[model samples]
Each structure stands twice: as structure tokens, then as C-alpha cells.
Target chain A: MHVKKLRKNTFFSLKGVMLAGIGSLALSAGANAGTVRVTVAEYSAKTGPYFEQVAKDFEAANPGIKIQFEVVPWDNLLQKLTTDISANANADLSIIGTRWLVDFVEQGIAEPLDSYLTPEVKGRFIETFLTPSVMNGKTYGLPIAASARAMYYNKDLFQKAGISEPPKTWAELEANAKKITALGNGVYGFGLQGKEVETDVYFYYGMWSFGGDIVKDGKSGLDSKAAIEAASLYKRLIDEGATQPGVTSYAREDVQNLFKQGKVGMMMTAPFLANQIRDEAPNLKYGVAPIPKGPSGDQGTYGVTDSVIMFQNSKNKAEAFKFLDFLFQPKQRIKFTVNEGFLPVTKAEAEDKYFAENADLKVFTSLLPIARFAPVIAGWEEVADVTTSALQRIYLGNGQIEPTLKDAASKANAILKK
Target chain B: MTAKRVVAPYVLILPSFVLAALIVIWPVNELAQIASHSVNRFGQLRDFVGMANFRALLDDPNFIASLWRTGIWTLGVVGGAIICSVPVALVLNEDFYGRDLARVIVMLPWAVSLTMTAIVWRWALSGESGMLNSALIEFGIIDSNIQWLAEASTAFPMQILIGILVTIPFTVTIILGGLSSIPDDLYEAAALEGAGRWEQFRHITLPLIAPFLNIALVLNTIYVFNSFPIIWAMTQGGPANSTDILVTYLYKVGFRLGKLGEASAVSLVMFGILLIFTLIYVRLTTARGARA
Candidate 1:
């Protein structure tokens, strides 16, 4: 009888605990009714504070609607988004790599913004930056950030090497590289990035200059003559010690560090390097120029943009669209672009004195005409991985160049087929 | 037994059983379901495609290479850790000067997070402006700096060394516990019998600690096999993926490549491999123990 009474008491407590849990959950749900949650990717240390301030301002201007921001690192944004989406716990809005926008659209995860967009808001974005996010006659994302690549050369290194001007052609670049390398005290001529993310894009500068496209006529162009020639040129640079020793070890950031330390003569990168150099190494003398031309004089630069997208499953569509409208206003856009050192995506932001008067940004703006955006397709990340690994093999001398390029081309073709 | 007693024990265990089912069994069931179906990159299920995901993994050369490399990584770290820890444990087992401080010093690596350790090592192993390169040059070891993570030949070995380093603290703790459980009288008795130090260690210490050693071996194998941070943070299985093990490959497939179906299949294969290993290892050790 005593044991039975104890069991009865236990059951009552368990029931009471569950009731408390349900009560708290319902209370939290009531509090979350008008919250607009946004997942912002952290580009640098300033990104979080900038977005937090924006959220506070939005909340103050529009009462009864709360704003919540989840700041994520750039490297882990996709993984976080993937898991969040699969678990059905994602935020209402997120910033995503425009290159990955194709997969998002195809999977029906991204909501089309055509219905929400007003003509004035639609006309604010530059066409080149805005076009990458449009699909199936609908705009699914808005370009939040955009950047273009340019060549950065150390002015001190150039003067020491007795070169009066930046190289205009590949041949001259090689000669200048050799001269700079000869002045060695643990110094390298060119800061070649043969490792992580954009390793293939680094090779693409040469491939494009040699008139090769990443994909042509519904197939990979990795095995084309122009690609082969581009690979050979980079290989010769590695062989002749014009680049840093062990090129396979240096990623984009590593090479940038070398450039900042004045240990490397030149490298091709985006305009943010100018911002980094100004802050990290103020005394270092550097100049920005166009990527050197190929033997036939064709040249190209990589243009990249990241987009802010709304999830199709969001319940607070009206509130989210209001926040999006406020985010793209010229005042907010100019502050964000200037703080993060990104090229302006909106016309009003571009006309700001900070962008129009900057000489370094001018070189990037001029190269906009010939810039190539990443091709819009499904499974682009897989294809980029294939190309990066193949380039690594070539850089490490683990495989012969021609056959390796052929093998990679065939592999990329298979992914493209899927 | 009485019905009341049997029923009472089960009732006491019911809550724990439910918790285990919620955390473990449910996820495995989900994975199995996803693995057997054609899934979109976002993990939404499409038509059922039995065994297609597994077959795809079998055909990929990178997957095969990573499988073999996982074997080497597990063996290298676990074997090397046991070998190194035994001696350190034996030394600390002796009542010497500042033994407490010494044990804490040995356990320092375990106090820090594995990812932080790996990141520090990456900076130290960098080709230029790295501490390791600068120290080597200072000591007149080589006239030039070596790019430690530039290729698989050097990078893989260094990674294994790091794995052993981080793994030493746990192994030593287990071995020390085993050593303490050993009675001091045995060594004294052996010494009285004219047995040497090595002989005492061989006959008495080794036999008594065999069970603890087995426990360490099994636990370390499980931990090291699934260890992700050291390799992922250092090389990310790169320089043409020469250093990729199973976990890193799974991350790339599941997250980077966004092939959830194939990634699920890869994880199932990994689970199968580890399960078989643990089962066989436990069986062999228990069988030996029974015989003795």
C-alpha cells in the first residue's frame, strides 16, 4: 500500500512538470509573434555591430515589431543555413553567396521577391550586380555586397626592382617577377595562391587572359588549348622560383599576408586588400592596377556578389519586406558598403563621395565592363572543388599537366551533367 | 524472482530507455531513411532509390582513398599514444620529486580545446613567418624554412604527431589508474625473490593492467577515429586532398558539396566500420580474459 502511494505521488509530479513546460513554451510563442529574425554573415569584426545598430534603429522607428539578428561567420554560413533549413528552424532572412543562389532557387527554398519589390527599389540596384540573383523571370534575392578583382603591387618593391610601371602583359609580368625575385632576402616575386577557396579562380585570371572560358558550349573548358597554355605558364612560374616556394601551401589570406609584409612584389586580388593594407600596414607603399594581359591581349577580372534572401517558409512576410525596404535605402547602403570596403550595389551609394573620389576603387570600377560573374548553375560548388583539386595537383607537380586537366574536365563535365 | 521485483526494475529504467530512444535510435532511423531515398540538396525526399547512394560512394576514388587514410590515421594516433603514454605513466607512477606538478604538466594539452590547439599548430607550421620555421633557422638546423603543410608527405606525418600529442593525456590518466590499483607489495615481494625491475614490471604489472589497457585501447580507437578538428583545422584535407580522412570527407560531401543523400550513405558506412571494429576488439579481449 505504501509503495502504491509513492508511485501515485511520482506520477502527479511528472504531470505537474509537463504542464509547466507547456506553459513556458506557449508564453515564449506569444512573445515571438512579431519578431523578424535575420541571419547576417560576418564579413569582418565590424559586421556584427553594424547589423546590431541597424536592428536597434529599425525597432525604435517601428514599435510593436521586434528585430532579432543571428550573426554567423562567413566560413560556416552555408553549413549553418543547410542544417537550419533541413531542421525547419531557419531565420526569416539570410545573406548567402550569390553563387549558391542557383541551388537555393531550384530547391524552392528562396521566396521570389517580385511581388514585394517596388519599381523604385528595383531600379536602385546596378544591373550587373543584380542580374545574378534573378531566375526563371523572378528576382529571388537582393545583392547586399559586391566586389571586383584587381592587381595590387608593392610600390617599394617595384622601385627596388627597377621597374617603372606595372606589367601590362603576361611576358612583362614574368620578367618583372624575375627581377623582383633576384632581390631576395626571404622575399618572393609574386604572391601566388594555390591553396584554399578561389585557387581555381586564381588560375582563371590566366585562363581568361588566354581566351579560355570556364564552361563553353555546354561543357567544361578545362582541357582547352587556352587552359593548357595557362597551366603551363603558372607551372613555369613555380618551376623558375618566381613564386613563393611550395605554392600549394599558400591560400588567399596567406598570400595577402606576404603582400602586407612587403615580402611579395605583386598579386591579383579584390579591393578589400586596400582597406586591409591601410589598417594593418600603414607604412607599406602599394598601387592598384589591372590584371596583366595575355599574349593575345585579352584580359578579365572576377566579379562577385553576395545576396540577401528571404525564406519561402517565413510567416512574417509583411514585416520582413518592410525591413528589407529599409535596409536598401541609400543611407543604410552607403554606411554598410563603406564600413566593409565593398563596391556599392545601388546607384545612390555609388555616387557617394567616398566611392567616386577613391582612386583605388576607380581601377576596380573601370574593370567592371570586362568582369565575369560565376556561371549560374546547379552543383557549382562541386564543380569548383573539382577544378581546385586539379589545380592543386598541377601546382604540387603530382600529375602531368595535360592529362590532369583532361581528367578534371571530364569530372567537371559529369557534375555539370547532373 | 517475484513479478513485482522484475516489474519494478523495468519501471525504474523506463525513463532512461525513452531518453535513449529519443536521442540515439531516432537519429539513426532518420539517417537510414534518408540514405535509402533520393534526396534533394536541402534534404527533402524524392523517389525511393535503394542502395544507389552507397553504390555511388563505392565508385568515387576520393572516397576510397579517404577510407584507407582513415585506417592509417586511427592506427597511427591510437598506437602511438598508447606506446608513449605507457612510459610516461610508469615514470609518473614512481614517487619522485614534484610528481603532482609533473602529472599536471602532462595533462595540460587535455585542458585546452582540440580546435584551439590545432589552430595554433597551423600558425606554427606555416611556411613563412611561422614560429617553427624561425626556430629551425635559429638553431642552424637548415639554412631555409620548410613549408610543413605544403604537401601530404610532410603534412600527414605532422598531423599524426599532433593527434598523438593531444591523445596522450587521456591515455596516461587511464594507465596511471591501472598502475595505482596495482599493490605495492607485489613489487616488494618480487624484489625479495631477486627479481629485477624489468621482470617485476613484465610479470606482475603487465598482467594486472592488461584489462585497463584493453579499455584504453577501445575508448581511444573510438575517439581518434571520429576526431575531426585537428585535420580539418590544419589542412582541411587539402593540397589535393592528400590528407583527407573519413570525417573530413563526410563534412565536405554533406556540407560543402551539399549532397545529403551521399553524405548520409558515407556516415552509415563509417558507423558500420566503427561498430564492427569495436565488437571484434571487445570480443577478442574478453575471450582472452576468460582464458586467463
Candidate 2:
């Protein structure tokens, strides 16, 4: 790998701090270790087993270290976190969504961990996790998991239609969808999330693989042929028999149900669904693929850096660093992430004997090289709003591409400046 | 009793007032302050943009559409709910072999969470595999399964339709309770006047229950207008912003977009609209009562 030269030199290198404090701060939570309470958005009632396992393992290794867990919802996750942080009552540990890292950095809710992490810890994970969380030349958190979206397909449906493999390009994907739909019995050939929020952003990025993007530099990327073509491609599947009829009404769980029930032939979904399908619908044969290439040849898939950052106001940075040390090792990281459906950050962990045995996970692991996150700007949440609204109008059959995309870009650029 | 009431009353209410300040009043004042600024993803309130957030919403085409859509939804769902509920309540109030059973069935939607109800209906109304659409096609009412929640044209109506199911239960119970309070004497007096059932309802029954009906109307209208979960879990105001109401739109701005000020402003607009409608309703109803 090439190390790009810095345009300007900073005298304080992160590498310098790690070596200086390795012994003083490397305190793992043990007999003398302090408890670090953490909060997270709940995934399931079964989450207890995973958390218990992680706590038991970390505690056994670190001696007296412990974890306190509180789970909320995706909708209220940020608000709850902020309320705690705003009140100076934030958790010692937090399992925050990757999308939120930038906003936290801006508010000074997170501590700059450059003063704490060892170079060994930094080198162990995918470099992208650190890059997105880094700002103004400082690292905020060590990521526990990296999530990316992929197209999941039912292998049985494809084989029955005489299709031996999943499509590699947008055109072939559409064509295969049509064939699968032709097989009939009211089966849809494709599924994609049209829900509002970050989920909607993923669908747009998937389309960007064919040459559509919501932003280009400081301008609208959605008005071009690529974006319009991408929009039309989705419309075609809806109009054709390739996708669930009411896909527009689908939330993440709704799509999950359809895919699990053998209703949808192809779907753009999270990597975790692969794990879920194994438990809920193990009889179903499935394969995962990268979001196909568009005319631009730059395929699109969203990666998440599920990171843990210290609240700036916390009075317990010493204990927090101890928790970070116990958390970073892949053994606990893999247990927390894989059970939660997140991909491991380290290449070795992604190819761990456990995840390696899961065929569908192998597909997600394969696509990690091309994964990119949405632009992590403070106003990005607002950009997603404008983009999702515009996409909704397009789907309604009344919206035009150029006007909407231009408006979106203009608004986004202002956000970028802020 | 009145001799020692003054200081005693003040002491009695002090704790309640303190709790109110801690819960409702504090949050409300805080909301007003927060509503004044565009907060970032973190909780810091940004520059004082004044009412620009509210003004921006006025200019937002999507907000305007949601405002109108909410008006239609409130009126349609509340209106349909009353229209269907009153008659059913009246019937269930009458002598019948299975009246108790029917009333129990009517109260079921109220038993389940609105979110749960929306989920169940979404599945039954799903386009291809939905039990409702599939059954309709099976019965030969339509050639193929229609996407009830998928297409733009049908999305709002479908939401209203599902909303009606959950709404009817509440409206019916309110009216039913009102119905039980009405003495049979009013109907007997109307019968002597050669009045039929419709005539009695127009004259005797309605006028007697007008107070209850109006209360039900205001409550249901407000509830339906501000409702978020039903449409969210079902259509999420989607298939192209078709099912968006003021609340979901505000949520999009406030929570999802992290434009808390704009969301709060939108929420204030929603409150303003409801307040106006409520005042108008009270004035009209009271005027009619005075005349009577």
C-alpha cells in the first residue's frame, strides 16, 4: 500500500503518543479496573447472550472489567445518546451508528483518542474505519464493526429459472429479474428499500454504480443520465413483475420478511440479513453479490464504521481506555459484531473460521474492498432528507430528475461549507 | 370547611405544581427555546435563525403537501370514523342476541398497540402476497392483486383505510358510552310525535349526545392528525410522500434530518392548525347549544 505524503507536516504524530503511554494507560478492566457502562440500540431480545458472552470474556481476561448495557431504537437512538451527553451523563461505552460519528465529533461529545491508541490497534483493522472517524487530523474512536450493504439473491429461484449465477451488471440484473418474474406464481423478481432515511440513501448509492450520485463535488449529481437511468431502472422493476408491488411502503423489516419468505428474488440489503436467513429460513438457498456496476464502472456499496468514542465530558477517561483495550481485540469484537450482523474490521477476523463457514457472509467479506460511506458532513442528515424526498417524488411518477438533483446539490454544498 | 381552606389548599397543590414544572412546563419552555435555533447532530443549538425555520417550512413544497394531506386525513379518517362508529354504537346499544360479543370485537383495535395494528394491516394489504388483495382476486372481484400500499394513487387511501380500522374502535366506544347515557324516554317522546329512527336521531338523539359527539370529534381529529406510527409502519408517508401528515413530516425534519428547530417549528404549525380548528368547533357547538 502507498502512503500518500502529507501536504503539510504536523509535528505531533499520533504514533508518538501511543508508545509513550502504552504501560500507564493500557489498564484493562480487572480487579482494580473501573466499570464502563455502555448504551446501544437494541437488535433483539436474544442480544443478552451476545452481550453476556462479550462481558464474560472481557472480564475474565481483564480481571474486574464489566459492561453495562442499555438498548433503544434506531429512531430514538441519537436523541437518547445526545440527551445523556448533553446532560453530562453519557455512558462510558457507546455502540453508535457509523453515520453519527461526524456529528458527535463536531459537538465535542467525543474525545480525541489519538492520545491513547497503540499503533498495533490501529493497524489491526480496515483503514477505512479510522479514516471516516478521523477529523482535523485526529482519531476519535476504535471501530468494533464495519457494516456494508449487498445484493442478496435466492439461489433456488435462480436455478429453477435456468440461471446459474447472479448478474454482475445492472442490465443483466434487470434481465435476470424479468426472467425470474416470468416464472410466475406471483413471485417478485427483485426487492429494494424505498423507505426514507439512510436506507433510502443506500438505494441511491446502489444506483450510482450505474452512474448516479446525489452529489458531485459541491453540485447535484442526480440530474445526469446516470441518475435518471438509475431511477428508471428501479421504476422498470416496479412496473415489471420483478419486485414486490408495494415496495414503496417497505421498511427494513418488511423487506426482510419478504426476502425470508421466498417472495423477492433479488434485494439490496444489509449483510446481517445473511445471518438472519440462516436462522429463520435455512432451507432457502442464497448467494450474496456486490452492488452491480453501472455504466460508470465504479460499483457502490455503503460501509459503516460502528465505532466506540469517549464522551468529552466523561470524568472516567482512564477507565474508558481500559475498556477500549479489552474491546479492540478481535475475539470480543467478532463476538459482538457477528452476532449483531456487523462485519469484522480486520481482514483476519472477516476470514475467521466462524464467519468463513457462512457462505453468504463470504460474499459480504469479498465486497469490503469497494465499500465507501456517505459523505460524513455535519449537514449530511439534512442532505439525506432532501434526497429521500426527491427520490419519493420521482417514484410517484410526477418528479423530474434535473430540477430535483440541482436543488439537492445546491443545498448540500451549503451544508458542506458549514 | 372554608375557614381553614386557603393555606391548606396551597400546601396541597404545591407538590403537584412542582411536578408539573419538572415535567410538562420545563420541557415546553425548553422546546420553545430549542425551536428557535437549528441544532446540529449534537445537541448544541446553533445561530438564532428566528422564525426562519417556520418561514422555511412555509416555503417548503413538501411541507405544504403534507399540510393539505394531513387536513384530508384528519377529516376523512375522523369523518369516516364517526359516520361508521355512531350507527354501529347505536346498533350495539340495542337489543340483540350477540350484542355483547359484537361490542367486544369492536374494542379489539384499542387493545393492540397502534404500531402492531399497522404491521398486521400492512401484511394483509401487501401487494402480491397480501391476504386481502389475494382474497379479492380469488373472489374474482379483480383480475390480479392490486398493490394497495405500493402505488402512489392508492397509498393515502390505504393508510386511511387501515387507520379507519384502528379508529373505529375508539370512536365507537366513546359514542357507545354516550349512547348508554341517553334515556329511552327521548325516543319514547319522539315516537309520540310520529318520528321515525332517523327523525329521532336528527332531533332527540343527536341533540342529547351532541356534547359527547363533539368531544369525540375533537379528540379523534387531533389524534388522527398527529398520528405517526400507523402511517410510518405502513406507508411511512411514501410511494412518493403521498401519506405524509404534519407529524411524520415534522419527525423527518426534527429527528431524522436532525433539523430539530425546523421540526419543532413544523410541530408548532401543526399545533396552531389544530388549535384553530378546535376553537372554531367549540364556538359552533356552544352557539347551537345556546340556541337550544
Candidate 3:
């Protein structure tokens, strides 16, 4: 009750402060200081205060410019942006998924940042983070945060199964999984994400590790040799009892839950799982490693990034760029990333001593160099669903590996053609 | 005075007409306009594509398959609902201990949203950790857990059962209301004629409840055909689109694929199909009523 009351009081005080700030701005209307309207997908309630503080700092530094924030909840950000795009009512600056950068560019909804960015600013970002938003030789967005996938294995389970080290190759991984399963009492070797959002991405960890991609030469890559091998690995795991039965029903969260409970020996997930494991299952001993390499010794992980984008129709381009420049400065970047629990998107932030000492983030930060992102093509989301369904068919259906993947490839090709 | 009379009726229904226009007619009109164009991922209208969108849907294999799946879904839900509810409604209509409590308990599934129901069932039917699996294992019904929503064979049937679960209470309440309105004198007369329980049910109860049953069938069929959240929240039309109905496929095409024009075409086709079914169903039942 006290906490709730304290929160309410804090909220009211914040409101009063904002109202007072607006009143002062209105009173000095003739000063010619302009406000850049900003909208960010609020990472949490704490983010609102941080943004307000940043706005105050920015205004203090630049007396002729002010920042106005319109914080949106993560769930409503995409929908709200779409509505705003159709009506030409978007805020001057907003953060959007890097996966969406291409579609937004194609629709002329996002303004290209090439003209506004200095060469020094362009060189500041980690090169891989900028690659997703670059289309046809034009950069349309700046990376704000990123996530990279890694393999999480139960150290206790490994020791119990007599494994001295985490698997470093696909063959070793499979053998280790079988060994772990052999010691099972309501335990599984691996927690495979068979269903839910980004089910395809889990499969892609293997596919890309084998040096394959979902798109190759502007067509579906599902039928490629690497992809087929990737699908076959999961099928074998399911058949050999190396993975839990009903692998097809497990989402990423479900797999994480199983792993945290020490019911699964291994899982490939992003770095966020480290925080979850620390808080939820402190007793469970675990190790993080780079994903097992595929047959050709190829290794990769999916890199998910969110970028700051400016709408083409915004009138406050100069002011929005000023805010973007300020936000991307090394000091501000570190603060934003630390609060957001995201991997740094800038080289300076990546090399920071704070990250080097953080053992949980060090594994992922090291893996950032080899991480690949989903293709930023239009209709990529639908194509991902097709791949997910195909993987489900292989795991849960009759386990016909080749034909199902080929069929999915054909379907994806058709979608891409549209 | 005639003008005043006409104006009075218009004024009385003006609010309803405006609401209808805003909610229904306007969106339908927009959908129709979009159906004839090439809409990009961001929903900006491109050049007019005429009937190409509809033609593409007609030729699309997934869309064609979902049509039959949708039919089976609609039929399964409506048939299962009627079968399950008639007995419950009959039992509820009787004088019993805690009859009011029984009615409310029987209708409880209708109170929860379909999305919540799906979420609960997803947990219950999960293979690794599920209450249903635990019970089945305890009873020695199966040696292992079933991935209920992962396989097509189980996913389709489980979705239908979920559809029935959600629709059954609505069916029961409507049928119960119809049962309540039935005059007891006819049942008493049938009993006086030396009729058995089945004879009374067949001769009096069945015929009297035909209109209500018809209403339930049409409404349930429509609801089942257009159901989205249950299927989406559970399986998302996975396992190679085996559980996909028209509505879920339409959702994928429109929202995920960002082909609003094609999705609008699918919507028009669905609308036309539902309209025809409702018309035929109502006409046939009403014709039987007139004959009776």
C-alpha cells in the first residue's frame, strides 16, 4: 500500500513538473525555440523518467531546442505507428524494428539519414548494426539497441551426464544431447522451440550455422542443403528422444522456463535469458557458449536490432537529428543500453570496460561479430510463418524432411514474387 | 401529417442508422474499394488492380484449402454445440437441487473471452506440463503425453472442441429460454396419451424448439466460421497450415503478409459465402415452419 501510494504521488509530481515546463515554454513563445516531438517504445515505467531527464539535459545544453516525449508501450508502438503513417501524423522521431526498416523505406515512410549524418557519426556505429537499415546504398535508420543469440547449457546436467565440456560442433551437440537424455528422470536433453513467434529463427540458428540462409539469390533457401540438414537434426533429436516429447508445443518462453527449472540441458536463446536464470533459478548452474558449429565449421547467430527512424513527413528534421546525435553519443549510448538491457550498437559502447567486466553480456558481445539478421524484405514476417509451419510439420507430423521443406520453399518463393 | 409521421420514424432510428453507417457500411465500403487496388505493406493504396486480387485468391492453394477447413470448422462447432447443449438445456429446465447454480455453472464458459479460453487450453493441452496430460497419465489412458496443438490430426480436432466449448453455453441458454416458453399443458396432454419420454420429446419438444435451434445453428456457424483468436492464440494455423480456417488465413495475409488488398478480397469472399449460407439456412427452416 505504501509503495502504491508513493508511486501515485511520484506520478502526480511528474505531471505537475511537465505542466510547469509547458507553461514556461508557452510564456516564452517569442523566443523562437522549437520542440522536437519524440516517441519511443517505453522499455519500462522507469524509462519515462530517464527520457524526461534526457530531455531536460538536452534543452539545457541547447537553449534554442526543446524535446517533447510521447512514450508508447511496446505492444502499441507498431500499431500506433501504422495509424500515424497512414494519416501523416507521426512524431518527428521514433524507434522501430530494424526488420521493418526496408519496408518503411520502400513505402517512403522513413526518411533516409544519409544527408543528415556526418561521416564521423556514420563511422561511430558498429558496422553490423548499421547493415540492416542500409538499403540500395542509403542508410535509413540508426541502430539504438541489439540482441545476439548464444547457447545456454546446464552445467549440473552436463556433469551428471559425464560431459566435461559444452558442445562446440553439431555432431558433439547431438551426442551430448543423447547422453543427457540417457540420464533422464522427467528431464530432456534440449529445450527446442517448436512453436510460437520466431520458431523459424530457432531452426535458422542451425541453418545459418551450416552457412545457409532463408533467402539466397532473391528466392527461398528452405530447400538448400544446409537447411535440409538443419531440419534433419531436429527430426533426429525428436525421434531419438534427445529432445522433450511435444517439442512442437514449446515456445521460446516455454523452453526458457524448462531450462531455468533444470529440466533441459541445453537451449539456444538471446542474452536476456541470463537475467531470467539469475533471478528465477539461482541454484541452477549454467554456462553460456557460442552456438555449435555446423558440418563445414560455419558458425552464426541471429542478431536482432531496433533502430531510431525519422518519418519523411516530419517538419522538425534538424531538431530530430540533433536529438539523435545527442542520444548516440558514447556516454548517452552506454546509459541507454544499460537501462534497456540491450547489447551496445556502437563500437565505443561495445569496447567499454563496464561491458568487458560483465560476464553475462561478454559471451553475446563477443558473438556480435558473426551474428546475422533476418532479411529486411517486405512480407518477411509471413515468410517466417511459412518456415515455422514447415519446421513444425517436420517435427510433429510424419517427419518427412525434404519434401516438406521444398514445399515451404516454393510457397515462400511465391510470396516473395508478390 | 404524413410528412411528420415519416420524419418521426426517421428521427427515432436516426442514431441507429448513423451508428450502423459508421461501424458497418463505411468499413465495408472501404474494404470493397481496397479489394480493387494494389495495397502495399504499409496499407498505402497503389494503382488499381481491378479483379486481380480476387483472381489471385481463387488460384491460391492455401486460400482454397482454408475454405474447406473453414466449412468443416463451422459444421463441427455448430453440430457439436447443438448436440452438447440440448441435453444440458433439458436437464437445466428440470426442477433440481441448486438449479440456478447449475445454470450459471453451465454458462460459465460463455463468460470468459475466447482468447483467455485458448490460453487456458494451451496450458492444459501442453505435453510437457499440462493438467489434462497428468490426468490422462494417472488414469493409464496413455503411456505418454500428446502434443495436442502441434500435430494437425490433434490440433484441428482440439480447435473444434474449443470452438464447441465456447459456443455450447450460448446454445444452451438460448435453447433453455425456448424450453422455458414451452407450455406444460402439451407435455401433460402427451403424457395423458400414454406417450413415453422419447415420444413427448420427439412430438412436442423437438418441433417447438426448431426455430430456436435454427437460430442457434446460423449464429454458431457464423461465429465459428469467423473465429480468429482461439485458433491464432493456440496454434496460429501451423503444422503446414493444416488447422487454418478462412479467417486465420485472411489475418495472415492481411496483417502479416501486409497484402491488405488481397486480404480484402478474401474478406469479400467470406462475406458472400456466409451471406449465402445464412440465407439458405433461414429460408429452408422458415419454409418448413410455414409448412408445419
Task: List TM-score per model, in order.
Answer: 0.94, 0.86, 0.86
Interface RMSD of each: 11.4, 11.8, 7.2
Reference-based TM-score, model 3: 0.86
Q: Candidate 3 DockQ score?
A: 0.26
Q: Model 1: DockQ against the native?
A: 0.48
Across A1-418, the per-residue lDDT of candidate 3 in tens digits comes to: 0001111222332233235334334433422338787777776456688889889989999888878877655533554566455545567888887887778888888998999999999999988788888889998999887889899999999999999999999899999999999996878898898876678989999998788987988999999999999888888898899998787777777788889989899999877677667667889899999999988889998898888899898777988899999989998888877766678788889888877689868889788888888887777877888888788878875648999999899989988897
Query: By DockQ, highest first, what's the ranking?
Result: 1, 2, 3
Flag regions of model 2 displaced more than 4 Å: A1-35, A56-66, A198-207, A211-214, A295-297, A356-359, A402-404, B1-26, B281-292
Score candidate 2 by DockQ. 0.30
Interface RMSD (Å) of model 2? Answer: 11.8
Q: How many angstroms is the interface RMSD of candidate 1?
A: 11.4
Number of the top candidate by TM-score? Answer: 1
- The per-candidate count of clashes, in order, stands at 0, 7, 0
Q: Summing lDDT over every window of 10 consecutive residues in candidate 2 chain B, give the lowest-scoring window.
A: B233-242
Off by over 4 Å in 1: A1-31, B1-19
- On the 0 to 100 scale, the lDDT of residue B166 in model 1 is 98
lDDT (10s digit) by residue, model 2, range A183-213? 8886677876666455456556556686566
lDDT of 3 by residue, B39-140 (tens): 876568889989999998988888999999998998998999999999989999999999999989988988876677787787788777888889999999
Q: Output the lDDT of residue B286, model 3.
A: 79
- CA lDDT, every model vs. true structure: 0.88, 0.71, 0.82
Comparing 1 and 3 by lDDT, which wins?
1
Among incorrect, acceptable, medium and high, the docking class of model 3 is: acceptable
Give the clashing residue pairs of candidate 2, or none.
Answer: A29-A65, A30-A64, A31-A64, A189-A242, A190-A242, A209-A294, A210-A294
